[model samples]
Target chain A: MDYFFFIDLIQSTVDGLLFGTTYALIGIGFTLIFGVMRKLNLAYGAAALAGTYIGLVVFLMFDAHPALVFLASALGSGLIGLVVYLCCFRFTPSNYPMASLLASVGMLLFIDEVVIHASHGLPYPYPSVFRDAIIELGDVWVRGDLLFVFFMCVVAMAALFWLLYRTPLGLATRAVSQQPRAAQLCGIDVTRVNMMTFGIAGVLGGIAGAMTAAAVGVLSPVIAMGLTVKGLIVVVIGGLGSIPGAIIGGLLVGAAENIFLLLRGVTERDIYVMLLLFIFLTLRPGGLFGSAQTRD
Target chain B: MLEIADIKTSYGKIAALKGVSLDIHDGGLTCLLGPNGAGKTTLIWTIAGILKAQAGSMKIDSEEILGLKPHQIVSKGIVTVPENRLVFPDMSVRDNLIAGAFSRRKEKGGIEGDLEDVLTRFPRLRERSEQMAGTLSGGEQQMLAVGRALMARPKILLMDEPSTGLAPIIVEEIFEIIGGLRDEGRTIFLVEQNAHMALKYADRFYLLEQGRVTFSGEPGAVDHDEVIQRAYLGARKAS
Candidate 1:
């Protein structure tokens, strides 16, 4: 590659990695709900953005700082996630996985429409928390916002790990994920576990949505459909119920999309990513890090 | 003390427990013996609150528990070590033990003491505390299941088919544990297909057949009943 091309490649790769942190957050939300309920929240991305929007309203309403905005958005999204669980999952017959899946898809459209109507379908600039805090390391330049997002993602994952591996609630969640009926026998309130898992996932989604909007510098309903699809792709690639699988899958997607943008232009970048998703589906459906399915 | 009176449990249209009633005296090792499909498991599940009784009453010392959720029953000091030792397969044995005390998580000090007690009771479990439960041997898994239930600090421990798939030697070891628990004053409701072994440990024995209590009396009565002899103990061939 030429000198400028090499520079472009490096820059794109770094940018992709930074943005991948957001994808990791969204993927975590998707995987968490899947792990506990064995059901996908197709509206997860939309829920995240919905949280961001509500947080925006609160931010503008109270003249809040970016941190407050992010927190408000996250908390709001958590509620949205709970609502989604009640509507799309709680009452639906569980024997048919497709029923819940379809319900979530419908939820995606419903929430998107609600946001569009509420916002009057106009694009709004999300508050930038660290956009001006750029870092320079010789020839490599890093955006401060991206670095902040990256830090947040790492911290969130660590907290999640501690909650799952070191606490009673975590134990209950894992037991429910592994065997709902057996967990019930252990005196675990399976419904409570499931509900809490959804709430947790919603918080993750909320963070992801806020960070994503900050990165793009704009928020609109148009992003929801694409995000939901991308989130699904990341979950499938990361192994549907695996936590670390989500992180790895998200980074892989971010890196690949950036490399493709340089090689095949913006129009063709998505096509190649779609191809990568298909390859994983056909060959390694268990995902990059999923444990082998076992029978007892 | 536990009371089951005129409890009817149905599986869709067919009734599995037809107004069957029984009482388990406190601090006794009471055993339920019957052939397959005779609702032995059904009655245990009903008392455990796994299945909602269609009609009738169940109480633990005047606190009605009939139709209560399973977790509620557990919180009320009734824990069921379900059939086949359904230990959390992928979790470590230590984690499984921790999960058993899930309802008592707030009682950290009590949980720690109960866990220590359980581990002491099963030395084999202590040796393999870090191992995944799925990797444990069948007898160990059964031990883990029982140990897990004990972590609940249950006043009433409900065990279903403890000796179903175990070897003869292992069965005796399980009975010894049952005897130990009774000695400790833990109320036990045991469901067993091993009529011969059950007879030896039972303080009060009930013989159920075709969804009703055919015989509710001493082990001596079960030994004399030709139906119980031929059906459960295989003591005599059906003539």
Candidate 2:
């Protein structure tokens, strides 16, 4: 390849890596919930979109600081997560995974429609925490917002790891994820652990939403469908319950889709990513790091 | 001490335990012997708080615990090593043992010490502490299950069929362990299909038939051969 083309490819790779960080955050959220409850929250993407709207509302109402806007949006999404748990998951039969899956899908549409009704199907300006400045790294230029998102993603994952491994609550959550009955016998309060997991996952999704909106500088109901698809793909490719798997899978998918766009075009990007997911499922159903114990 | 009075539990419409009552004194190995489908496991489940009793009362040291959740019963120092050696298959042996002490929050240092003590008692667990509980052999898994229960530092340990699917030597080893536990003045309530083992290890035994206690007494008072014949082969004859 020509030197100029080689440099462009390297820059594209950098771009993919930057965008992949957000995908990794979303995948972590999905995997965290699925690992414990063994159920998919189809509304996860919509929950993120709803969080963006919450950020917009905060910005418009109080002209709040960017940090406050992010915090308010995250809290709003966490509340929505609790509602989803109480309305969809709490009463559903424990053994019926499909029932919960369907309920989550219903929730996804409900939230999406509500957003559409409120915003009138128009894309609203989402206040950017990071101004759209370009950072020069040698020959390549990187967006400041994308770099900020990458930093936030790292912070979120670190916090999550600390919550999961360093604290008593994390120990109880892991116990419940591995063996709910045994956890209960140990007096871990399984339901509370589950609800907390949901809330935390929702907060992660909310952060992803805020980051995405900040990166693009706009929010729309249309983002829900695409984000939902991307999140699901990332979770499956990462393995359902493996935290590290989600991060690795997210980066792989992000880079792969970008490479596909570079080689072919935007139209075939998702098809190649979906095909990669199919291949992973066929060869190693456990994702990269998921153990056989996750099978049921 | 434990008292189970007139407990009735059902699955849908079919009753598993029907007005079953029994009293176990403190500091003895009491075995419950019955045939398959004789509601022995049902009684164990109810007492462990896995299944709610429709009508009954269960007391641990005179505290009523019939309607409490499983963890609550565990907090009250009544723990069960459930049938099939349900030792949290995915977790490591050490993790499983640590989970046994989950109900107790105080005495972190003491709990760690107790874990060490259990490892010494069941050396096999010490050798395979990092191994997943599911990968251990049947006999080893049984040892881990018992060791996990012991880690709870429970006042009363309820074991259901710990000897099932083990070899003859392993069964004898398990009985020896139970014997040692009794010698230490720990209370154990065992449910077993092996009449011979029950007679050998249990201080008092209850013969259950279809959810009701048909016989209860010291091992020496009952005819050992007759109980075995009836328990294993359903041989009911005139007195």
Task: Quote the lDDT for B46 in model 2.
Answer: 86
Residue-level lDDT tens digits of model 1 in A115-221: 99998999887787678888886666888888887787788788889999988889999998887766877889888898999898888888888888878777777
Per-residue accuracy of model 1 over B1-239 as CA lDDT, tens digit each: 98888889999999998888899889888888888888988887887777788999998998888988878888999999888888898899989998989888887488888889899999999999999999998899999999999988898999999987899999999989988998888899999888777788788888787788767776765543554563474323336
Sliding window of 10 residues with minimal summed lDDT for model 1 chain A = A287-296
* lDDT (C-alpha) at residue B230 in model 1: 39
Off by over 4 Å in 1: A2-4, A291-296, B224-239
Q: Find the candidate with the highest lDDT and give its number.
A: 1
True interface contacts retained by model 2 = 0.53
Clashes of each: 0, 0
**What is the DockQ of the complex in model 2?**
0.52
lDDT of each: 0.86, 0.84
Recovered share of real interface contacts in candidate 1: 0.73
Q: Residue A239, candidate 2: how far off, in angstroms?
A: 2.0
Model 2, runs deviating above 4 Å? A130-137, A281-286, A290-296, B106-109, B235-239
